[model samples]
Structure formats: C-alpha cells, structure tokens
Target: MFGAVPALLTYYWCMKMPETARYMALVARNAKQAASDVSKVMQVEIEAEEEKVDKIGTASSNSFGLFTREFAQRHGLHLLGTSVCWFLLDIAYINNLFQKDIFSAIGWLPKAETMNAIHEVYRVAMSQTIIALCGTIPRYWFTVVFIDYIDKFTIQLMGFFFMTVFMFALAIPYDHWLSNSAGFLIMYSLTFFFANFGPNATTFVVPAEIFPEKLRLNCHSISAASGKLVAIVGALGFPYAAQNKDPSKTDADYPPGNGVRNSLFLLGGINCLGIFFTFLVPECKGKSLEEITGEKEEADANDMQQASSTQTFPV
Candidate 1:
C-alpha cells in the first residue's frame, strides 16, 4: 500500500511529458516537432535542424530499414550485446530473488511457525526494507556516482566478477553458512549489492545509449524480453532441481544440494560467462549519444548545433 500508491500516481506525471527529442528527431524524422518539443520542455526557442536532414534525405537513401544488410553490419553486434547481457544478468538476479528463503534462514528473521500470518508479513517487509537500506539502495547510489567516473564497462565487469566470488563463497560452504547466519547474510547481501551496482543498471542504460534512436526502443524491448524469459525459465527449473526426494526430509536440506548446489554453481558460472559477454557492450561513458550510435552522425550533430545555437545557456 505504501509503495504502490506513489508508483501508480507517477504515471500521471509521465503521461504529461512530451515525446522525447530523440524519438521526434530520430524515429519520427520530424526535426521541427523535435525542436519545438525541446523548446517547450526547456522553455526556450530552438532552431529546427530539418534542413540538414532534408538535404541528406536519409529516409530515401536508407530504404533497407532495420533488418537491412547495412543495419546488420552496423548495429547487429550492439543488439546482440545488449540482449545477451540483460538476459544473463536477469536470469541470475531474478533467480536469486525467487529464492527468498535465504533471508528467512538468516539470524534476524524469526521462524515462520512462531509468527502469525500478519506478523510474518510484517517481519518480511521489515527484513526487505533493511536489506534495501543496507545493500540494495546504497549500491544504486554507488553505481550512479561511479558509472560516469569509472565507466559502465568496468562497473559491469567488476560486478559480475564479485558476484561470482560471493556466490561461490556462499555455495562452496553451504552447510557451514547454514548454521552461521551472520556469515550467510553478509555473503548473500554482497551479491545483491553487486547485482545492482553492476550489470543490472548497466543493462538498461547501455541499450538506450548504444543503439540508434530509430531502433533504440525495439532493441531495449527485445533485450528486456529476453531477460524476462530466461528469468522465468530459471525460476521454474531451479526449484524442481532442488526439490526433496526423501519423504522424511524437510524442504531446507532437500537439495542436500549436490543437486541444489547445482543452481548456485550454475548462477556463479553464468556470472563468469557474463564477464566475457560484457566485452561486447562498448563503453559509452564520457561520449555523446551521437558518438556511440554513429548513425547519421553528421545530421545528428547538425540537429544539436542548430538547437544549441538558438537556445540560450546559463552563464
């Protein structure tokens, strides 16, 4: 109830916003509308760069469209890069999320049978809040602070490497940490931290930057869809693999986990593979969106120069 209200209300504000300059200029190819939107949003006049785009008549020349040979040679790699990284990152992240019992096993949370349904819900909420405060929230700020300074590629690489280390650290001595709640909590939380500060954020940011605006939304949707698909598969498959065979055994030790351990090890290996995939996504930090996409660079620059020349800057 607390979080849901604000989230629902936010759509009203978002709906109020005009179409972005990127979509107007790049996708719609309506530079006058794009410039007018910029002027409206910024409360200033902006010169329309339609003349340059008109001169090039790129729409006529590049009739091959998104699936063309030219597009494949130019941007197919970036499409693959964004898709694979998002897929790998979400598979691990969502699987970790679905396996929420790890937190209940830790020291702070009370056993379920001891608490009533309401109390259990309250406790779960409180625990998640604490985890967000300690691990999830801080790491987001960490990424925002350093994503520009250190660059997106390095952050993503370091995140996967550390996630592998932490997952292995937790999985290798699973029984030991099972009894040692503080140790398990620390290791588990570190994975959560790195996932946020690393690939999770980068996956979203890079796609928007690397792909040309015309195909940007398509690439991001495809990449995001792939991530969700794998996440569902992993979530469904891992539990089945971890299911208990013995009638007398509890769910906790069911994996006794030569089988259960497989999931953790699999996720760790997935992160290990992610390090290699991260290389496919080029570093875009400190570069303009124009430089990264390199589609119609001359025309894109003319649009910016035209808009910038007319718009007054703060001294």
Candidate 2:
C-alpha cells in the first residue's frame, strides 16, 4: 500500500511529460512539436527546422528499418557490447538477493531458525542497510562526481576489475573470513560498491547515446531487457549453486552443491568477462548525440550528394 502511493504519484507526473524532442523531431517527423518542447524547457525562442527534418526523413541512408542490413552494419557490435555487459552485470548483481544465505554460511548472520519472523526480518534488513551505507550509496555519488571527468569506459573497467579482485579476495580464503566476519563484510561490501560505480551505470547510458535517434529506444529497450532476463536466471539459480556441498552444512530441504566459495569465484569470473565487453561500447563524453551516432552527418551528406548528381544546369 505504501508502494502504491509512490507509483500513483509517479504515474501522474509521467502522464504530463512530453515525448522527447529527439523522438518528436526525428521519428515522429514533427519538427514543430520538437522545437516547441525544447523552447518551453530552455525558455528560448527556437524555430522549427522543417526543411532539415524533411531532408533527413527523405534520405534513404536514414530511413532504413530497424532489422535491416544497414542497422546491423552500423550498430551490431555496439548492441552486442551493451547487451553482454548488462547481462553479466545482472548475473553478478543478483547475488545480493541471496545475501541471507551467504551471510549465514559465513557465520556473519544467524540461521533463520534461531529467530522469530519479526526478528529475522529486522536482522536481514539491518545487514542490507549496512551494505548499502558502506558500499552502494557512496559509490553512486563517486560515479556521479567523476563520470564526466574520467569517462564511462574507464570507470566501468575499473569497477569490474575491482569487483573481480574483491570477489576473488573473499572466495580464495573463504575459511579465514568465516572466523573474521568484519573482514568478510568489508570485502562483500566492495563488490556492491564497484558494481554501481562501473558497468551498471555505463550500460544504461551508452545504449541511449550510441544508436541513431530513430532506433535508439529499441536498442536501449533490448539492452535493458537482456539485463532483466539474466537477473531472473541468476535469482533462481544462485541459491542452488551456493548451497553447501557437505550434507551436514546444507539447509533443510535443499540439496548440497558447490558452496559459497565456488559461487563467489563464479561471480568473480563473470565480472572479469564484463571487462572485455566494456571495450565494445564507445566513449560519448563531450560529444553531441548526432556526432556519436553519425546520423545527421551521414544523412545530410548522402542527401546533398544525391541532389548534386540529379541536378540539371541551363544549357
């Protein structure tokens, strides 16, 4: 019921929001509406570029359908990069949901049977809050401050590299951490820190900037959907994968498996893979949207070249 209030408030505000200026101008071919929207927001007297919009709309180079060879030729590698990175990030990120199992295994958290329902909820919530305070929230501010100065690619690369390091650091000496819960909590917190600071932030932003205006929404949606799909798989699979291999240590009604140490190693390996995929996304810092996508330049040049070829001079 509390969640419903926020959802209702958001819905009211979302309904008043206009379609993006880029979408209006490019895909909708409504340069006037686009100009109007921008003028309202920027509080400036802006004229609609109907001729420019018409030229772009008529250009064959810009008019290709989403599934055509042209799109593949242009953005295939970019799409792959965005999709794979998001998929890998979610795979690692979903482990947060299994924190209770992980904490119990490491002796940081008490077993569920030791506490009543209310107490259990309080303990779990407190652990999650600690992690958020130490790891997740601070890293987000760090990303916000440095992203413009340092570039998304470098931040994401650094994030994945550190996450891999921390995961391995926790996994390799798993027994040691079992005795030292403070050290374990610190290392565990670092993973969430780098995650928000790295590919998690870049993957969402890069997809929007890299694709052409006409296809931008589709590409971003595809990338986001890929992440969501991996999150679902990871949520369902991680608990089983992290189950104690020894029958004596295993939870009731659950089969023994590779255990938490191996699970951390697996997640670390996934973060390592994210580093390579991050190379696929291009840096868009300080560049115009048209410059990054090459849509405006390519379409304008094609249209001009075509006009030049078809022109007839008076004899």
TM-score of each: 0.81, 0.93
For residue 117, give model 1's deviation from the true position in Å: 3.3
- The prediction achieving the highest TM-score against the true structure is 2
* Tens-digit per-residue lDDT, 1-315, candidate 1: 799889878988898878888777766778999899889889999999886645444643223367888778877887888889899898788655534455544446676667898997887787667667767989978987888798989989999999999988887887787679777767777898999999998898888888776677788899999898998887766665554344343254445333435567878998998898888888988887767766457666767988989998789
| lDDT (10s digit) by residue, model 2, range 64-151 | 8789988888888899999999999999998887798888987877877888989989988999999999999998899889988988
Task: Supply the global lDDT for candidate 1.
Answer: 0.76
lDDT of each candidate versus the true structure: 0.76, 0.88
Q: How far is candidate 2 from the true structure (C-alpha RMSD, Å)?
A: 2.6
Deviation in Å, model 1, residue 10 alpha carbon: 4.0
Candidate 2 lDDT: 0.88
Clashes of 2: 0
TM-score attained by model 2 = 0.93
- Which regions in candidate 2 have their CA more than 4 angstroms from the true location? 299-315
